[model samples]
Target: MSHASTAVQERPTPPGGPGAPESGLSSRSLPRLAPVGFAAVAIVLAVGLGLAAGWHSKVQWGMIAALFFLAISYAVTSVVENRRQAKDRLATSIVWVCFLIAVIPLVSLLWTTVSRGAERLDGYFLTHSMAGVLGSEASGGVYHALIGTLEQVGIATVISAPLGLLTAVYLVEYGKGSLAKAVTFFVDVMTGIPSIVAGLFILSIMLIFEIQPSGLMGALALTILMMPVVVRSTEEMLKLVPNELREASLALGIPKWRTILKVVLPTAIGGITTGVMLAIARIAGETAPIILLVFGSQLINANPFSGAQSSLPFYIYEQYKIGEAASYDRAWAAALVLIAFVMILNLVARGIARWKAPKTGR
Candidate 1:
């Protein structure tokens, strides 16, 4: 045979072909041991610390340290084996840390409130309306303040909701030119305006009209304070509605107003509701405006339009200022109640958001 022909017949096959060698990794892959190893070490360390210091002492710091180690291990493994994994692992760790940091204070507040406030949260506290229960008789509830809070805040919500929603729609959907820009700029400015300033504005308005300090004045002040937040939140939520949905509606010969009402609003309704609830929560606990505008009344005031009223915030302040141990306890209890109410509002917002979320699967 010729040399060339023999050479061709003797040539080796490609690496991955019929008689080729396998690549670096095997077909049956072993699970990466880094995470497992890290977890094992973390458990052992945590257990040893708990045994030495008692579980209660180790609960907070020990767990936090273990989580940090686990995150570091994941990061190291990712850098060694997978480039994309590194970024994702790092981001996940950061997000978790952020969540934990946010949750810690809230949990602490709630736990403390529940622990300390239980004494004053009884039926007597709810029924007597703060009439004559004095000097640590252990019988006064927050009925009057609760009523005042509900009525004044209810009025404020009614007054602010439509105005804020319309303002947001105009800004996001129809706003244009210098006027719109000016309105948006001012709204942003108003968002940072001091709560006391809002009170002063309402107070000045009342003074001009010869109206005395009253619950109505307080509601008006709160409405002013809350309106900007509502507008900002609602505008952001409305802006999140996809432009494609608007175009699709327009293509179907829907009027702009109808499209906003039926299509856009409904699509972004979850976020809008959540934002509104959050805005409400933000203002409900405000003491500055309410205290400045409304005189605190021990008796329950059903009418926000007429006389002085006492909301939880004002009640807390009033009780705190009395300088008695009993009054101080009452103030703490009121604080607990206010915090609970805000938490309930947040929970409700979350529920509404979940319920109103667009169905992804039929």
Candidate 2:
């Protein structure tokens, strides 16, 4: 035979095949059914263990199944592929499990609230008030509480929004040195203060001044609770506004304050408004502050500055405390209304955000 032909015949094959690598790893992926298959096996095992052990809780069984799924997935992937791939799959499974765990309670709460509250929600329940209706009677409404909530929240927002915005502006735009740090520290401290603490703080002030319990007093406590939230949120939003926008305005010979007013604020206004609304929503359902300051009233009181007032949350608590079937129904109904109110506020804030978002030509 010729030398060239002999050389060709003596040449060795690749490790696996003609195009295969020397490494044992394959380019092919696991079957798409792998997760489903593992889940099925886990479910079977979990169910068997639960039945055999007489475990009554489905939650326990599901948790066991989830653990099995994670373990089996990691094991099979490690055996079939490599440790790195196995770790990635395990991490993904863990993330999904955590997400499911977090979402389950939220979904359950919404479901329970909606199902129970829908029974007594009606026009009569909304437009009328508990002014003359007895707690044990089935004829009361939440109108007074609704009015009080709106007025108090409105007053609180008015009091806090501007102060918070100005504070945020100072922090983001021109704040410096020890003063700025002190303000920032206090804002952080205030943010973590409990609602009850805020209520008590206001109650102390009220006691010192001999002030009466009224919607305005509740609003003052709410303002104190809300300002820190607004400051934090608005400060973050202001920080998000590109510095280039401010520089551009400055280059045009605009004053620093004007630049902030016309450019910086407009840029972050959507977020600021949303934050303010969220703050309002946060305070809207506070019962402690209302109880301490507003001193819940069964009768309607339109004036916030004088006389005891009613709020949706306080009204719910009062009705629930009555422990009667009618009161329970009213409480649930009021809760539904309050939830709807907050939901509406959120929807409106979202709508405003979309509407006011900076226009960019696509």
Candidate 3:
């Protein structure tokens, strides 16, 4: 053979699989189907072990399966690839397992709620007041509770949303030194305060003034619980707005307040709306404050400012406390309504956010 041919034969294209990875990258890795195959094996082994060991709980079965999957993934990857690859596979496995652990329970709870709640959820149960929903009879509905929740929540939103938005703006735009720090410290403290504390705070004022139980009282308690969340969430959203936008607006000789109103507020409107909705959701389910302030009336009190009223949370608690078969149905139905109300708020927030979001890529 010629000299050129000899050199070509000597080199022979350094042997390895096609398109092998370079340094600082993986050379060999697990196949895409490897996880699925490993999961199947793990399930089989776990089930066999569980049955043999006389385990009755499905939770134990799931735990054993997760353990087997992790072990199998690491061992197989280490043998097939390398220790580094095995470690990566192990971490990924751990994350998937943890995600399943969180999601499975949520799915189960939603399933239970939907199934149980549907039994008593209907137009009749919605439009009629529970004025006479007595024992062993399904004559009453959640109309009264719905009215109280709407009136109380609306009043609270009107009271708290603006205060939260302005406070967030001050903290981000002009707040400094001792005042800002003090405000932040108080907000943080309020964020951690229990719902009962807010109720008691309002209750003390009520007692001092001889004020009667009313939806207005519940709104006041909810306002305290809501403002801090609004402040924190709105502050984070405001901080996310690039300083360049503000600077550019201010360079045109616009006043700081005007620039904030025209530029900053619009930009962060979506997040602020979401934050407000979250705060509303938080207080919407609070039974303690309502119990203390509104006092849970069975009769529909449309005028929230004067008379006692009932809310979805309060209604659920009262029904569940009855412990009758019909009461249980009404309780589940009220729980479902509460969930749906929160979901609608979230949807509205998302819609508002999308519509008001700053346009880009013109």
For model 2 the local lDDT of residue 59 reads 94
Give lDDT tens digits, candidate 3, residues 1-362: 69989898776444364444332244567779999999999999989999999998989999999999999999998877867788888999999999999999998888898999999999999998877658567678899999999999999999999999999999999999999999999999999999999999999999999999999999999999999999999999999999999999999999999999999999999999999999999989989999999998878899988989999999999998888999899989999999999999999999999999999969
Compute the lDDT for candidate 1. 0.79
Q: Which of the predicted structures, 1 or 2, would earn the higher lDDT when compared with the native? A: 2
TM-score of every prediction relative to native: 0.76, 0.90, 0.92
Residue 215, model 1: lDDT of 83
Candidate 1 — number of clashing residue pairs? Answer: 1
Cα lDDT of candidate 2 equals 0.91
Ranking according to lDDT, highest score first: 3, 2, 1
Location of the lowest summed lDDT over 10 successive residues in candidate 2 = 20-29
- Candidate No. with top TM-score: 3
TM-score of 2: 0.90
Q: State each model's C-alpha RMSD to the native.
A: 5.5, 3.4, 3.7
Best by lDDT: 3
Q: lDDT values of the candidates?
A: 0.79, 0.91, 0.92
lDDT string, candidate 1, 1-362, tens digits = 69999999899876545563332222332256655565567667667666776666645654755675556666574545443555555566567667766888789878887787776776777666677667455557688888888877878889888999999999989999999999899989989998999998987888899897778888888888888888999999998899999999999999999999998888888888888888788788888988878878878778878888888998888887878878877888888888878878889888988898778798
